[model samples]
Target: MSHASTAVQERPTPPGGPGAPESGLSSRSLPRLAPVGFAAVAIVLAVGLGLAAGWHSKVQWGMIAALFFLAISYAVTSVVENRRQAKDRLATSIVWVCFLIAVIPLVSLLWTTVSRGAERLDGYFLTHSMAGVLGSEASGGVYHALIGTLEQVGIATVISAPLGLLTAVYLVEYGKGSLAKAVTFFVDVMTGIPSIVAGLFILSIMLIFEIQPSGLMGALALTILMMPVVVRSTEEMLKLVPNELREASLALGIPKWRTILKVVLPTAIGGITTGVMLAIARIAGETAPIILLVFGSQLINANPFSGAQSSLPFYIYEQYKIGEAASYDRAWAAALVLIAFVMILNLVARGIARWKAPKTGR
Candidate 1:
């Protein structure tokens, strides 16, 4: 035979095949059914263990199944592929499990609230008030509480929004040195203060001044609770506004304050408004502050500055405390209304955000 032909015949094959690598790893992926298959096996095992052990809780069984799924997935992937791939799959499974765990309670709460509250929600329940209706009677409404909530929240927002915005502006735009740090520290401290603490703080002030319990007093406590939230949120939003926008305005010979007013604020206004609304929503359902300051009233009181007032949350608590079937129904109904109110506020804030978002030509 010729030398060239002999050389060709003596040449060795690749490790696996003609195009295969020397490494044992394959380019092919696991079957798409792998997760489903593992889940099925886990479910079977979990169910068997639960039945055999007489475990009554489905939650326990599901948790066991989830653990099995994670373990089996990691094991099979490690055996079939490599440790790195196995770790990635395990991490993904863990993330999904955590997400499911977090979402389950939220979904359950919404479901329970909606199902129970829908029974007594009606026009009569909304437009009328508990002014003359007895707690044990089935004829009361939440109108007074609704009015009080709106007025108090409105007053609180008015009091806090501007102060918070100005504070945020100072922090983001021109704040410096020890003063700025002190303000920032206090804002952080205030943010973590409990609602009850805020209520008590206001109650102390009220006691010192001999002030009466009224919607305005509740609003003052709410303002104190809300300002820190607004400051934090608005400060973050202001920080998000590109510095280039401010520089551009400055280059045009605009004053620093004007630049902030016309450019910086407009840029972050959507977020600021949303934050303010969220703050309002946060305070809207506070019962402690209302109880301490507003001193819940069964009768309607339109004036916030004088006389005891009613709020949706306080009204719910009062009705629930009555422990009667009618009161329970009213409480649930009021809760539904309050939830709807907050939901509406959120929807409106979202709508405003979309509407006011900076226009960019696509």
Candidate 2:
């Protein structure tokens, strides 16, 4: 403490000489309401210019307002503060512009889907099947497709999740050298493999075997697409487990495999479960594989392994392609249902993760 005090006292004077004022804090700053004022002015200027030019596009006005807001913010900040502060404000403005640009299209899509789908979405629509409904009649529901989707996705999850978990454990815990490298290389490859490619690969196999279309075949294709995502996500979660935890477990006379099963897996289970759910969400909406393998059916097929089946994605596509008003309504309704299904899966995943999270002492 004495040495620190002495060193502080002995510190060299500034190049400006003794008693120079500190430069650590800003000498000037903008008012808190300056941004709001700038935005209001920007909006008015944009509207006035648009009106003078006889333009009717609100998008153009919004873009112009954004540009005016950014420019005015930078210019005013530079005058009130410094170039560096002005640059920071400009960067923040650019980020906001980019965020709005990304979000607008998503909001627009949701609004359109909900408005159109609400017309035909009801209990009768949800309970009946399209077995006897005509393209122009619009009196059927997606219950059959919903059943097929559930079965196919459930089968894929059953097949892929355990395999992915095992592969990730191997890579993290016991893997080394060329074999591990090859596995890692293939995993990265599979991560980017197109969904259609997986479908086509399964289709070729079916052609060779002369097998009929079934939901199990579609499930297999989905499994191929889902496994890599599970492996990548689980591997990342496992890597986050501290080596010290593993070492302490080993020091307590637990075998490595037992330690991994208990200490490591439980620690990472929440992330692992979430990743599996995300993979399920990704595969749940896939239409290509279902088209190539399941061969969409109008009547419900409870037996996935032997008969044709319909899935929600395929149902949406089939209805949309029919070129009738009723079909369009059904398509929109199916889209809304698909969206809700994915959203519910995500919510369930969050709940499971929270429930399984390790507790800590207060």
Residues 27-116 of candidate 2 have per-residue lDDT tens digits of 679998888899899999999999999999999999999999999999998877767788888998899889988999999999999999
lDDT tens digits, residue span 1-362, model 1: 69999999889866556565423555545897898899899999999999999998999998999999999999998877667778888999899789888999999888888888899999999898887788799998999999999999999999999999999999999999999999999999999888999899989999999998999989988998999999999999999999999999999999999999889988898999899989988998999999998988878889999999999999999999999999999999899899999999999998988898777788
Clashing residue pairs found in predicted model 2? none
Cα shift from native, residue 72, model 2 (Å): 1.5
- The 0-to-1 C-alpha lDDT of every candidate, in the order given, reads 0.91, 0.94
Q: Give the TM-score of candidate 1.
A: 0.90
lDDT of 2 at 195: 93
In angstroms, give how far residue 284 of model 1 lies from its true place: 1.6
Each prediction's TM-score versus the true structure = 0.90, 0.90
Q: Count the backbone clashes (under 3 Å) in each candidate.
A: 0, 0
- Model 2 spans with C-alpha error above 4 angstroms: 1-25
